[model samples]
Every structure is written in structure tokens, then in C-alpha cells.
Target: MSAPADSSALLQTPLNALHLELGARMVPFAGYSMPVQYPEGLMAEHHHTRRSAGLFDVSHMGQLLLSGPDAAAAFESLMPVDVIGLGVNKQRYGLLLNDAGGIIDDLMFVNRGDHIYVVVNGACKHGDLAHIQARIGGRCTITPQFDRALLALQGPLAVSALQRLLPGVENLVFMTGHGFNWNGADLYVTRSGYTGEDGFEISVPAASADAFARALLAQPEVKPIGLGARNSLRLEAGLCLYGNDIDTTTTPVEAALNWAMQKVRRTGGERAGGFPGADVVLAQLDGTRPLMRKRVGLVALERVPVREHVELQSLDGAKIGEVTSGLLGPSADKPVAMGYVSPELAAAGTRVNALVRGKAVPMEVAPMPFVPNRYYRG
Candidate 1:
């Protein structure tokens, strides 16, 4: 087993040299030296992906292969998601929770016929793997694929660009996956991504990552994208950023992620309350107890942008909540934000105040995906 990352030591992704050569501005993130932005900058990269395809190096995220007949059931013991119900080649969003109903991490799992493939947050992957292995080592094998690198080619033109390299890639629908041979290595291609656009995540050999990314970048519709644009894109799509938006202190329901909780895990289902935090999580789902605060989207009527950790207040000057993630949405061309506030204030059209520099800046609670989602369902 690999030791924990030291405080000052920074790990490098398989595509580190590619990013540097492409003139990406590097920064420390999730204990790795990663690209924060590229030469075209965040704004350009954001808009480019919206209009065309942008290739992203997400190799820092953990990829694991959970094998054995009991893998699904054993995996379910650690999270609130219905792993057994996931069909072959299908994928689902999952919440990893603690015993007290707070989120340990949010992840995505794919059923690969004989085994399950998982992708976890870059920062939480190590701890998440250790947790899973410790809890279910007797039932199944959790093998971390450290030798693989993940790439996300995202945007409206992602399909066309990807199809140029691998024909028939456009045939895949949203949340579906298939294994393909690329560059003489077995690759797993999933028609899913975090940008809320129609895209795909490619899992390839770490040794081939640079060449794979270069091949994608050579396409007319593709360009190299960095982390800065990725953050803004996900924010506009109302997706949560692990530590900033959700942590051990936040529950799935409180984070407006009830959709990620499968029906089987809720009250009155066949297999209810077996996983971690099922008591509190299912109770929240059943509405037996009222929820105090909930995550909601906000749109700035004013042009000024609000940032994370800023206090949110009610019209009466009472602090209701605080911003978890906020930024100027490039696609929406407006300041968009997501934060926690009293449930009563979480609805659309509700007026609220953000304390910016000790002054109350007014905004409205708006429905998310501030821009529409363009996932291909077929």
C-alpha cells in the first residue's frame, strides 16, 4: 500500500508535462501540482468548451476496480447508493457517507459486467479507497488502478472530435460506458463527465496519457483546458466541489443531492437502512423530520461577483447561510452561485442578501443548471 502524501510534497499527474508544455499556470491542488489555467485563460477556455471541445486531464482522480461476485453488495455497505441495481455498462452518481449521515465523499461508479469501476475526488480518493478496503476486504478485492490516467473531452463538439479518433464513440448515450482498444491498450470509455455537457471520460494507461491527450488535442474541435474553466463550468451546472461544497459535515439531502440517492435506499424499499448513515439519511428522505438548511442557486442582479465563504443574510439582517461556491458564470454571462440557506429561503424568487465588504448585496434564489444541460440521453 502507498503511504499518505506528505504535507509539502506535491504529486504530478501523468499529463503534467503536457500541461506545462501547453503553457498552463500550475498550482497546488489536492496534494498535486496541477494546472489552474492555461494560456488562453479561464474565460476563453470556459467559452471554448461551451462552443467546442476542450480536453481535460483529470488523472488525479482515483480509479479503482472492485472485483468478485459480491463486489456490488460489499461496495453498497460503504455508501448510500444502490450498487446492485446498477446495470451492466451503466453508471450512477453515489454518495459515500459516514455513520452520522454526513457525506464522506461523492463518487461515480460504473458496472463493468464482472466488476465495478469507480472514480472518486482527487483529494479524498486515498482515504476513500482505504475506507472501502478496510470495510469489505473479506467480500471482494478493491484494486486501485494507479497506472491509469483519466481524460475528459467535453463540450458540444466532444462527440465529433472523439469520433474522429475512435469511430462509433458517438453511439454511446449519457451515463453509459464501454471498453475499447486504443493505442494498443484496453481503454474504458464512458459517455459521462462533470461539465454538464455531452462528453466522455476516457480511462487509459498512464504511460499513454500524454500521447492520448495530444491525439485528442490535434482534432479541429479540441483544445487543452485547465482546472479554472472546469470549476466555473461545473458551478454553472450546479455541481458540488467536494471539500468546498460538501464535506463530512454535510448530508446528501442538505446538499440538494437527493437525486443521487437511489429509491431502494429510501424508506419502505426492499433494502432500506443497511448502509452507513441510513437512519438519518433515510429519515431526511422520508421527511419525518424537517430539514433546516438546503443548498440553492443564486443569480446576481448586480454585476459584481460573490465568492465562497461569504455570509448570506436574510432581508431582516439575520445570517441565514453562507456561500459554498460562487463565481462569474461565463456561459450565463452573469454571477452565479450555490450556497446553503434556510429551507424557507431556498426557493426560486426568494430575496436574500450577501454580505460583501460589510454591505448587503441583494440577490435572488434561482433554480440551477443556470444554463440548460445538454446531456445526450439516447
Candidate 2:
């Protein structure tokens, strides 16, 4: 996919210099020069994160705060997820959809008392912001928090390392967030991350980000991670990537993200029917149409890395689907991938095949997260 075409200069995160010093291979992503891998390579970095701790620079993402008397009302008009019922300090994954029900982007939305804070994927940030701004009308105030850098500290040792710098950081439970002080600087800490592990994603003031990141890496278990490892880790956990695994052409029903939609957002709710794609989304919710299922998981064969657009076929050579994302999982120690398929063929253990290098390889429709998730529940 092409990066944003705006003539504005690419924005740099506070930790850009640190990444360069660590021998990171920089690449253009979301209009910013970002690291895709380091000297350790993707496999090594991916294993390091699962076994110890890894830090990621996600500053390219867009952060916004919605504040107004009708913030919940305004939000309900853009996405199908329930906002009014969201508890403070809790975070929920949701999608921003266009009027026709096409996905604008997937995002993490946190309810903070009077204001709603959201973090969207970097590649879709501009388009997401523009869509939200145009439809928000005069009911709410949309404020972008561009003066912050987002850092993900993910792994089993994440809490221990973070607690050493910011006491009481371990108090946060899964999917929860809180405002805290680190070295006397204000920080927004959320018990969330892309990797399926116990972790925290902290939003720190731009100026202090570099200093804070340096402090974290000073610990024994903490190490710098890059986008290459990030992708492999998430794929092993069966998580979706914005443009690849999902996009405007897909729906939550097809993407296996129905859990994100709350009961209040159903057709019966007071304001549930006003959001974009309400008709189609509601119909799918009501089961008025056949839902095509797309699952994210691993393949058994160790020979090749599954590439996107590769056709998925039935055992008898009938084409049934296509791959969206694929790679060798450092944690799984094998080739892992995700693809879309017919709903009847989407069940776990269902026999299937994938065409790779002009040859059909035997594969099975397996359950996701090849490895179980280890998020801290308490």
C-alpha cells in the first residue's frame, strides 16, 4: 500500500535516534521513517520478546480525545461498538466504519471519565481522522494528541520492569488504563499491546520519551524491538493487521471480531441504528445474509512463507479462499499464516489446502493463536 501522499514532511518519533544507534534498518511506513528490523533479525527479536521483554516504537499511530456533552452519542454514530456502556479506565477494540459499513480502520478506544481517547493504526491514521472529523458535526470536540509517543513494553517481564520505574504500574489489569507519573513526568499507561502477552503501552510526552525508553532498556530483560518482530509476534498470536488481514472491504462478522460489538449496539438500542453501514451490519448481526468467515492462524508445512493473494483451495483442487498474511513464526518455530475461507470450511480441524509456488500443499483450518494468550487477568 502507498503511504499518505501529503507533501508534509514525515514525522519522527523521539526514539528515532535511539533506533538508528541500535543498528535498526529503517523503512518508510505511514509516512514516517520507521524500523522494520534490527541487527538481531526478525526471528531473534520475535523470540526475545516472547521469552523476555521487547520495546516497540508505535509513535506513528494517531491518538485523539473526544470530549463533549454528547461524546458517547457522537461515537455511536461512527462505530457499532458500545461506547455509553464502556467503563472508565477500560479499553475496547473497535472499528471505524464508513456509511456503507466498510471498515475505515480498527482502533483501541478508551473511556476516560468525560473524554474518550482512541489509538488508531498509523497507516490509516489520516484517513481515519478525516472521516471522524467530517461526521462528528458540532456535537463533540475532537482533539489530537500529537505531542506524545506510544511505546509498547510487551512480555512476561514487562510489568516487573515497568513497576521498577513507575511504582503501582502492576496494579493495572488487562484491558485497563490509568494516568501515572514516571520520574515526575505525566504518563498514560494502558495494560494493552499487540503481542498476546502481559504488557503495557505507555503514552509519554515527546520530549521525555527518549529518556524513558533509555531507562527501560537499561534493565536486564528489556531490549529494543522493531516492526518485523512486531508482525511475526502478532501473527503467531492470530491478531489482525489493519490493511492486510482487514480493510474497508471486510466486515466484523467476516473477520471473526463479533465479540467487539456489544448488546447495546444491536438494532434494538436507542441510538444503535444511526452508525455507518448500520443496515448491512445490523442485517449480518440479525443473520439476514450468509456470513463469509476469515480466520488468522498458522500452517503446518515448514517449507515456505505464505504470501498474500496466494489461493487457498479445497482438497479436491477447488479454489475456496486467499491468504492475507503469512510468515515464519519465531515463537511457533514454523511457518504461520492467516487467510479467508468459506464459512463451512472455516471450522477448526477442517481439511483444506493452499497453493504455494504452483503446487498445492496440504493444510488444515486450525484454531487461532497457535500459542495460547498469556495476558494478565488480575
Candidate 3:
């Protein structure tokens, strides 16, 4: 996909100079001139991550802290997740929705005991904050942690590598985090990542980011990975990339993210139908209103790979859907994609055709996480 076409100068991450020093191929992404790849290409970086650990500079993401007694309730007014019930230090994936039931953005929220901490997508961060402030600022204190840098350490060996720097981090199973003193710098490290691997996302002071990244890279198991690898990794793991697999026009139900909604917000529950779009979302969840179409995973049956926006047609030449995200999955050794289609055609094992270059390429509705997830939930 083409980067945003605005003529404005791109922003730079705190690790921008470090990326250049490491021979990164910089490209404009989400208003930032960030590295898409490095000396090692995408494929190598990907496989290396699956086998060992990959370090990613995710400082471009927005980090915000919400404090005050009304933080949970104010935040809960936005999405349907049980924010008030979210346990301390436990993070949950959530969606921001419009009143019309369309998704505004997806984010990770953690109940930090004393406050609520959230990480949102880079491109939508400013608007997301503005919306939150306009709606809930009177109740909660919203502070953007721009002075902090975010980093991801992911793969099968991620725990071992991280434990070397900060012991007891391995004790933080998936979806949990807490403040720690690492090399004398305060760090909030979460045992969670986008790659579907057993990994961690660490938030540190921007001034200490470069040095910390260097320290991690010095480990034999960790190597610097760029956005090119990052995209492929998350796609293979069946994770959605905001604006691609999901957007303002897509609802959480249509996007197959219904699991993100908690029981407390469902029918006959304590907080039922209180969040934005709750009426629409609950109708779909309770089968009061069936969804017309649902997002599904697709795997090309042939060696030829397909790209996004390619029309999916029935065998008789009727369009059913369009590919939202597609790529030659390195782990699958085949083209994998995800898109929305009629409810009947959303089942796994269903057959469809993708129109590529005016010809139809056969595909199957396969299960997601084209690569198996290895999260350490235990």
C-alpha cells in the first residue's frame, strides 16, 4: 500500500539516528520516516524472529496514562470491553467505536492499579486522544507519554533473552505487566506482543531507548527488525493492522473481534448496552440482528500470490468480497489473506476465487494465525 500522500515532512522516532546507523531502509509510514528493513532482508528477519528473538522500535505508537477515580468508567463509555472489571496489571485488547457501530481504532488497555495505561496506533493517536479528551477529559486526567519509547522483543527465545537483562520478567505471563527497575531506569514491561509469539513490549524513557535497544541487540538471540518484518509477522499471526484489515467502516462483529467484548457488557449482565454502538454490537452478538457478512481468512490454492482489494468472486462469477490484507506468508509458504464475505461463505473450507489480473485464482477460507500462536498464557 502507498504511504500517506501528504507533502508534509515526516516525523522521526527517537531511534531514527540509530536506525540509520544500523543501515535501515527508511520509508514514510504513518507520518514517520521509519525503517522498513535493514541490512538483513524481510524474509531472514522473519525466520530469525520465529526461531529466536527480534527487537522492534515501536516508539511511534502513542502511550497514554489515565488517572483519577473515574478513569475506568470514563474509558468504558467509549468501547464495550469491561474496562471497569479489567484486573490490575492485566492488559486487554479493545476497540474504539463510533455511535454507528464502526470501529474507530483498536488499542491495548491495562489497569495499572493507580491509573489506566493505553497504547494506540500511531496514525490515529492524535485524533483518538482528542476524542477521548472531548468526551471524558472532565472525568479523568489524560496524559500522553511522548517522552517514553516503546519496544517489542518477540519470538520463541524472547523470554530467555529478556530474562538476561531483567530477571523475573519471565514470571509475567502473557497480557500482564508492571513497573520495574532495569539498569536503573524505570520501565513498564508487558509480556505481550503483536507477533503471536511469547514476547514482551517494554516502555522506557526516550533518552534511554537507544542504549537499551543496543543492550538487547548485544544479546546473541536478539536482532534488530524493521517494519517490513513487523508487518509480515503480525499478518502471519492473524492480527489486524488498523486501516487495512479494520477501519472506521468496519464493526467489531463484522471484523470477527466479538471475543473482545466481555460478559459484563452482554445481555442480562451488570453493564449491558452502555458503551458506544452497544445496541448494534449487542444485536449482532445476541443474534437479534444477523451480520450480513463476516471477516474470514483466505489461502490462495495456487502458487500465485494475491494483493489487497482484489475482488473475491463465486465460482459462477458473482463478487462476494474483496481482499483486505494479503501476502505470501513466509511461514505458510503460500499466499494468505483475510477479508469480509457473506455469512455463508465465511466458514473455513469454503471455496472462492480471487480476480487477479483479470483471471480468477482459486482460494480457500482457511483458519487464521496462518502461523500458530505461541503465547505463554501459562
Q: For each predicted model, how many residue pairs clash, with residues at least 3 apart or on different chains?
A: 0, 1, 0
Give candidate 2 misplaced runs (Cα > 4 Å).
Answer: 1-9, 296-298
Q: Considering summed lDDT, which 10 consecutive residues are worst modelled in model 2? A: 1-10
Worst 10 residues of 3 by lDDT: 1-10
Q: Stretches of candidate 3 above 4 Å error? A: 1-8
Which clashing pairs does model 3 show? Answer: none
lDDT of each: 0.89, 0.85, 0.90
Best by lDDT: 3
Q: Higher lDDT: candidate 1 or 2?
A: 1
Ranking by TM-score: 3, 1, 2
Clashing residue pairs in candidate 1 are: none
Clash count (model 2, backbone only): 1
Instruction: Compute the lDDT for candidate 1.
Output: 0.89
**What tens-digit string does per-residue lDDT give for candidate 1 at 1-378?**
122446358888999888889999988787787888998899999999999999998888899999999999999888877899899999999988899889888898899999999999888988998888888989998899966899999999999989888888889999999988877978899999989899999999998888888999999999989889999999998899998889999899899998887777775666767888888888888798689899999988898799999999999999999999999899999999999999989989999999989988888999998988899998
Q: What is candidate 2's lDDT per residue for 1-378, written digit by digit as tens?
A: 435544266667789999999999987788787888999888788888998999999999989999998997788778888888889999999889877677889999899998999999888887777888888857899998866899999999999889999989999999999999877789999999999988999999998999999999998999999998998888888899988888888888788887888877875748666778988888887889777666545485646777778899888888889899887667777777899998878887787778888987767777788777999998
Cα RMSD to native, each candidate? 2.3, 2.0, 1.3
